[model samples]
Target: MGSGKRSDYLPEDERGASFAQIPTSFGHELRACLRCRLVKTYDQFRESGCENCPFLDMEKEHDNVVNCTTPNFNGIISVMDPARSWAARWLRIGKFIPGCYTLAVSEELPEEYQNICADNNVLYVPPKRT
Candidate 1:
């Protein structure tokens, strides 16, 4: 009688492998300006959060701005600088947020990113308090 062959359920090499490697060059280690969409590497940043962006010279949009839940809110407020210029030149107005700025929170934020919020003025409202 012929003996039936037993199948190996798991791959020999994959059984102990940790995981796949993340791509190195997908991004250039650069941060893009949220307003003018300028991409600058870490070395080019003027300050911790500020950079010299081409769009910084462009106009701004001040009405109905959006922010996030931050202890400081300054980072978000700095973002509004561009929008304020946009409103003044195009809309011919001032005071972007007569109403409260819209705040949105993601599932989780990186520690550095969270620090940006912590050093700025923002009202953070979580769905549920921990």
Candidate 2:
């Protein structure tokens, strides 16, 4: 078996020890990041923030967490090896940290946060509503 430390499998930039745990079950409190679609409970988001979208600074900021994350997402995907997973590539999350991600987030991020993303050189693509 592999070592217990999940950080060992993550990339250098994403080596935060806290991101090792990914939510595995659907729950009412689960929310998905508007930018990266990483799935986590409300408390988890408040505690650790989004692993892929740290610029949002969701930790302890209830407003940020509420405005940047959506509970209306669809489908859950657990990505272990983003570099080699065709599903991750197809979902455009190949460069994101390995974790449970939503297939589609069904809400829009606030314009303010969108601008923040732009200012940070991060593209904010809204989810398709088809």
Candidate 3:
């Protein structure tokens, strides 16, 4: 039920799927930030990506935005030793265990994923399912 224009429009190629379209079947340990595209996992609840997110500061509506529980990630970066992990330093994640760190796969999802989201009434994705 759109007005033939996207409010989230950002050029043609840059347009991508929203974070809600991402899968949650992976498990509770994983979470993805739609804004920063950071798909890192946690050993427990406290380690999620909610802390000090760049998007949280940018978006004023704290309630409507997604939480730390976000899942079904992409672009994994494995850190064998978090102490010596250069990626962690770059991403500004002060603490990370030895595991795969996935990047958020927001926007421009593959056609197959788009179909999946559409059929399931994906709230975050922009494409209309007709």
Off by over 4 Å in 3: 1-67, 105-130
- 1 or 2, greater by lDDT: 2
User: Which one is best on lDDT?
Assistant: 2
lDDT ranking, high to low: 2, 3, 1
Task: Report the number of clashing residue pairs per model.
Answer: 10, 0, 6
lDDT of 2 by residue, 10-128 (tens): 34454364343577446798988888888989888888888777778898677899999989888999999887999999998887778898899778889999888776666677777
Write model 1 residue lDDT over 20-98, tens digit each, in one string: 1121222444333332222333333322222221112111321101121122211111223333565322421122212
User: Model 3, poorest ten-residue lDDT window?
Assistant: 11-20
> TM-score per candidate, in order?
0.22, 0.83, 0.29
For candidate 2, the 10 contiguous residues with the lowest summed lDDT are: 1-10
Give Cα distance to truth, residue 124, candidate 2, Å: 1.2
lDDT of 3 at 124: 31
* TM-score between model 2 and native: 0.83
User: Which ten residues in a row are the worst by lDDT in model 1?
Assistant: 62-71
By TM-score, the candidates rank as: 2, 3, 1
Off by over 4 Å in 2: 1-20
| TM-score computed on alpha carbons, candidate 3 | 0.29
Q: lDDT at 98 for candidate 3?
A: 39
Model 2 pairs whose backbones collide: none
